[model samples]
Target: MRNGKATIHDIAEKLKVTASTVSRALNDNPRISDATKKRVLKAAKDLNYQPNNIAAALRSGRSKLIGVVVPTANRNFFSSVIRGIEEFANSLNYKVVISQSYDDFEKEKQTIEALLNVQVDGIIASLGKTTKNVDHFKKIISKGIPLVLFDRVTNDLDVSQVVIDDYYGAFQATEHLITEGCRRILHFTSAQNINIYKDRKRGYEDALLKHGIGVDPELILFSDMQLEDGRRIMQETLDRKIEFDAVFSSSDYSVMGAMQVLKENGLNIPQDVKLVGFGNEPFTSFTEPTLTTVDQKSIPMGQITAETFFEILNQKDQGSIIPKKTILKPELIIRNSSINKEN
Candidate 1:
């Protein structure tokens, strides 16, 4: 009846019942008799009746939908987090709408606006690299919508966040390299505009200071942490004759690039130059020499993010929910890449 779709009125007409009775029966109202409810359900099935969720949402003032924004869905870390979010949200009978920012600030703002237009109940997001100004996110708070940040978050926002201890993760990785006798360790990292990368850089520096190794400014190279950037940086380091015994990259892709350059120059891994990477990407384990890296507990982070949103929803006043910061500990995964041959 509504745009050629079967409606409660159609079911009522087929069953020779009033539309109100059919509606109550379809909703399983206790006032409806069991026989009548069964009959209405059967008629609905026969007519293929479908309830309009948008209409129901308008009536109830709740969409039962959650929006998730990530930098990229292609990366294993984000994908795994999404899977965990889906798992928990589905269990609670909630649906999730996902949007990818692609690390672009404009795209991120557009996606958030689109999600808001659809009247989602809540949003969970990781800030994009280019998202320096967070006024757009503040707008979500202004609209009384619950927002939770994960992974790459900003301290300027007073919202719930789920993240790993990136500082400790980097510290452990750097200290591991030092223990393996890597004196002149070159750090391949990304821009410090993002909080996660900044924490990693600080951790790397602190680890060196703790182990009596002075931080070398020339050895700390900043890049986009892409494969090509890694390759280019490594080649330039070689061209400049920079002395380094180990390479600690903030990204697995960057490590792969460095590995390629090292291999081409006939440098043996763990013998000539030890290596370590972050993210614990799948490829790290299967490489010629498995990469030592840090596991960010991405799935757990996702689950916690969803759980926190649910808690926010339960509160009578959204603003009353205290700003929560949940930091999960990072685990160091040791492998062949950074282990000294003598050890």
Candidate 2:
């Protein structure tokens, strides 16, 4: 046995078998008897043998490595989605490499390039807030690598995508606020360049118009939707004396900032001013007066995104498969933040 990393040859030598037989046994080929397979596995374990994935990849032209890009990794929504993706991918003997864009378009592009350089078999990504142009992503398809976009995606790219119905989720959130007797609803969101935010803004506007309320442009505020942005927007609205009975924020972090300002001003929640947020973050349920929000089905989105990638991989030889769009339904979790007492 060599002093270096144990190879299949070492296991074969220990078991008095050929390297080809050891390899077949390791892969659980049907021709290998169960007893032989067990003996080979025990020998491999005893030698601390580790498969050289790089060598195997070179032989098969598949790395079995998946690259994942998210706008940010700190958020619960994205984290949960990643967990789901890893869960499914790991079961299939695939590994995942994760990268965060921090919502920067340049960073997102760089991440894709880096992943490509590593020759990952596939990529799953969520667009950054500033990712209006998808040319960088198109390049991935040009290279014949499978790409799947989740949560944030664009129709410009002919790629498989998994996302929740952002428009309907926003509409439900806004309609719920309106039903709770909030006429002047303020919207706090991120850049409209992102399709998810754009859909949410449209939903908010349409919901108001449906209820015979004229759309107020001033009520809509766009920012990075960070906690500080939320605080600033809320404080600015209060300072300007903007008439608003409720707020529907596109992010939970921003909503928490708004809630802090409301508390500071001694405004009674759900009484003086109701509030709702998108993305059912963990903190939302634990906050005082538990926030009402939309559940984007993040985990399922990731699972389906990974599943879709495998589907494409399986059908790769059947000529190019048509791109598909998978839209999941969002659910509203009503809590003290926006529950109507009279209902």
Candidate 3:
């Protein structure tokens, strides 16, 4: 019986009981006697029976599954977000289905389709760098599925969104440098598809303008959010013989790149060129002079995102509630890198 396919009827036949009784025992119905349940279990064990997940999902009204799509799960920023999502989702008795798009728009679309095919109850996502099409997301909305966008969100989509105040954070970082007496500040940034980079750029530029400093286009370097991009941009700065007093980078990794070169050239931080980086990553503190960066309250952002998604799930009058764009203020962490010590 274990070698061949085993069925409820097979167990019933062996036990001289009706199929209904066998089913009840297997289901552990309260009405079934303990002795009968034990017998049915033993029989099932002997037959090596297994329940089908697909069949079970079909029987239940909900798949009890939530899909999570991120640009890359490997990134420290996104991994923290995923941790927050998983923690909240688990407490609500829902399972998570995760997929990575590697910042590819087409791959993101394909992953969403697959999630839909599996009938996920909801979706929580951070848009990829290359994701320009909002139609895929719109379709999810049209299907009446709840979607919570965290971190990277599209402006076109009218949905629940959780984000940090990038502009303010950027403003604060740049302002700190200006107050420290660093003029001719340089700004390093990446693509403007996402609001974070754009806001930081704005903050940096605005701070300079407010301080009566003329904005220099040559000082603004566009770079990819990669270690090599940082190294390459620093090299370009050297090749151009661009004299600058300070540097503000939108990414911590890029700041690290700039610092490596600056240190090699024996230019002291803060004394020669004040430095500030966004995204207060872990390595920021351990660096030689430590790093002055912006802390976006990443953990809280994740928790709020999870809470928002759950609220949408439980609210009976979800349509009546205004679509929310929750923005949290960013905190500027001033460290040794950006502050000068008078001898």
Candidate 4:
């Protein structure tokens, strides 16, 4: 009875019927008569019959499991994405398992290996900040398993991927500051070799060039984009007397850090210094002066990421090379931080 749990055989024995008939009745096969099906169900209830999902999976050749990997799970953006994936996947009777790499390259590789070992139907992931090699991801492709990437993607793999238009978001932010009468804007970016940061930097530069304000190398600050990094960089910039009237950061955390430092130094936001940040985190709205930032469409990205994974799994030819690439639009959320009341 499978370690005290009632099985199909117990139900069949109770009803004096064959195990096959009980299985068919439980599955609601049309071939079984309604009267017999009703009898089988009654016996199953009385015996507390439980079906073995492992056996069913083996017979059907499907685990009905999906794995999701992210750099950090605590962030609002990644959590929203996970919600979207779970909502859609649950609707299809699939379960999800999530893992975090903490932006560590080795941890990422280990996470992928563990997911693959579990024989999950597919995997959806965002690249880790320190990930520069694609060999671990290639192992999944070699095994003919579907692997879909979202947000932080690498160009080395020909796999289905989803990302926001970072360039456009950055351009919009930079241009908004310019319209607010900010010419010498300081840009806070990450030093890691990630595509999103690179695209944002390019957008920032292009917007400055378009407005006849040349890019200043000294004004571009690079770090991990953490809160402490922002605080330290702003203080250093102030100490060095680098002239800047506005701040455009690629991350909300760093920009928020910059805001605290600015306030502590007796600088007034939108009065003496304008500000804009990427990724409209929840805290942005509750600040003293609301922050202007970009929304990355986290929920939609998660939903589309799940849809893309299923698409790959259901493909007629699993060996196809034409992978899908989806680019979502980013919205600029303007607020009190970047608006110049004087202008």
Candidate 5:
């Protein structure tokens, strides 16, 4: 064994065959005989042979490795997306290198640069909250490397991407509350710069206007949509006496915080204030009155994102990527939180 790891040459020596023969046998090349291939395989197992992917990648210029970047892996949505990416990638004999940006633009830039340094065949990413300038992504395009975005994407970069219909999901949630007789519906959202948050806001506004309930600026609240942000915004609404009958949040985490505040204030869910949250987190089902939420289809999102990346990669040698946008439909799960019978 060389360097405590069995190399192809080590297997060749074990079986008393040429290094080329061992290589061909290991690759299952048609030129090699079945008996010799069987001998090479057994020798490989006995020696615990491992292929040097880096050397192979250098020779072929195809890394068979993909770099995946997300805001954070802590969220169930992002974690599930990673799983989906891995499932699809692994089927094609590819490996994934995951990196987190933690919502920092600088970190995202550095992460992408590091991925480039590793000579990854492609990169699949979701834009971080603070990533307004997309020059880093543009640089990737300029280098003729495949870059596909999913979920949190920007329109500035002409890249292939996939995302759930945030507008439709938000519209459905808002309309559901309206049907529940909620006129003064409160809204929790993030910054308008991000496409998902903006689409959701538009949906909420259109739903209210469609139902003859004008959008009240006072009822609209903006924040990072973190747990603390939800609690702070909700408390601010009550302190200012915004007068809201229902709450619709763009994030399940934030709405959970709002629920805690409501319970503390002695407000009965679905009785006094109907609530609906986006992102069908697992905890939503276990809540006191089970929070109504939207399913972003994380599994499908990840699968499609992987497919989109490969599509771009397969077409790279042909020319630049012809940017494609795939929008998936989201599902709204109705639960005890949004069904107010007495309202």
Candidate 6:
């Protein structure tokens, strides 16, 4: 036994029986006599013989493991979600294996294949920006393995999805800017393929519409939610000679990049160009302007995802359960970015 892990051979030797006999006893084969079955089970318990899960999975077509696919571990939001998932999974005696897609569809495909090869009972996933073909996901579903999509889920799939109200959060933030007397507000968004981005963009649009302000397509720009992407976009805005009074970015890192560019231009934050960002990163408050942003309930989201997956897994023995889709509300955190002291 390695690291206190037991092998079937240990139990069979202890009971003076063949390894096959011990296996049959564990599986409750009718061929094994009751007395021998009891003796084998006692021996297994005494020696703490735990069957190899890999072999068991091959026989029963399932390993009590849950697979999770995320973009990356760099962000606090994703890390918190993983923590929540792990905690919930541990409490339920289930193991979790996580994979990083790095926003690459090919990496995602390979990760999913690896999880499936291990015979995971279920999968929890957040789609990458480059994920356009969902045929691989469909194939996983066809294998009778339940799938749960979260965060950046595909709009085309008819599957259960979990995420926050991005549109409302963005709308609220934009509206706050309008209330604060920002006549020219720029919106920095990410990929349009994902539902979260689409929702946030819709919110930005709706806020402008509600305020009776004319929508300027030129004021909106899309980036990859990276520091460099944010820096490039802000530089381009400056090159266009656009004098915007405020900027609302979809990501905190992007907001930071914009701030860096603005600071280098000798432009005072709030006094010159007010800013707001999404995803309440821990470092937001420490920024010079202190970013105003949206607080996505990440820990709860992760916990709920785990709970929902296990709820489905528990019901699998009975039959299919009614599909569940849960959407949580995001709260806006007002900071120096959107709120000028003079106002």
Q: Which of the numbered candidates is closest to the native, going by highest TM-score? A: 1
List the candidates ranked by TM-score, beginning with the highest. 1, 5, 2, 4, 3, 6
lDDT of 5 at 172: 99
lDDT of 5 at 46: 87
lDDT string, candidate 4, 86-192, tens digits: 99899998999999999999999999999887778888999888999889999998989899999999899989899999999999999999988899999999844
In order, what is each prediction's RMSD in angstroms?
Answer: 2.1, 2.6, 3.3, 2.8, 2.3, 4.5
Off by over 4 Å in 2: 1-22, 30-49
Global lDDT scores for all candidate models: 0.91, 0.91, 0.86, 0.91, 0.91, 0.87
Provide the TM-score for each candidate, comma-separated: 0.92, 0.89, 0.87, 0.88, 0.91, 0.87
The reply for model 1, stretches above 4 Å from the true place, is 2-6, 20-51
Which TM-score value belongs to model 6?
Answer: 0.87
Writing each residue's lDDT as its tens digit, candidate 5 over 234-322 gives: 98888787788999999999999999999889999989999999999999999989999999999999999998888777774637447
Q: Which 10 consecutive positions of candidate 4 have the poorest summed lDDT?
A: 50-59
Identify the superior model by TM-score, candidate 1 or candidate 6.
1
- lDDT per residue, candidate 6, 1-343, as tens digits? 6688777787877778898998998889999999999998888888877677777888877677899999997798888888888999989777889899999999999999999888888899999988989988987777777788888887676667789999999999999999998878899987888888989999999999999988899999988988888899999999999879999888999989999999998999888888999999999989987889899899999999888877777774524556768998999999887787875
Residue range 1-343, candidate 1, lDDT tens digits: 7677998888888889899999898878999999999999998888878777677777778888899999999899999999889889999989999999999999999999999888888899999988999998999999989999999999879999999999999999999999999899999988688889999999999999999999999999999888999999999999999999999888888989999999999999989999999998999999989888899898998899999989998788876779989999999999999997776
Q: Model 4 segments beyond 4 Å from truth? A: 1-56
Give the lDDT of residue 266 in candidate 2. 90
Assess the local accuracy of residue 279 in candidate 5 as a C-alpha lDDT between 0 and 100: 94
Model 2, span 64-117: residue lDDT tens: 999999999999999999999999999999999999999999999999999988
TM-score-better candidate, 1 vs 3: 1
Residues 83-121, candidate 3: write the lDDT tens digits. Answer: 888888899888889899888889999999999888888
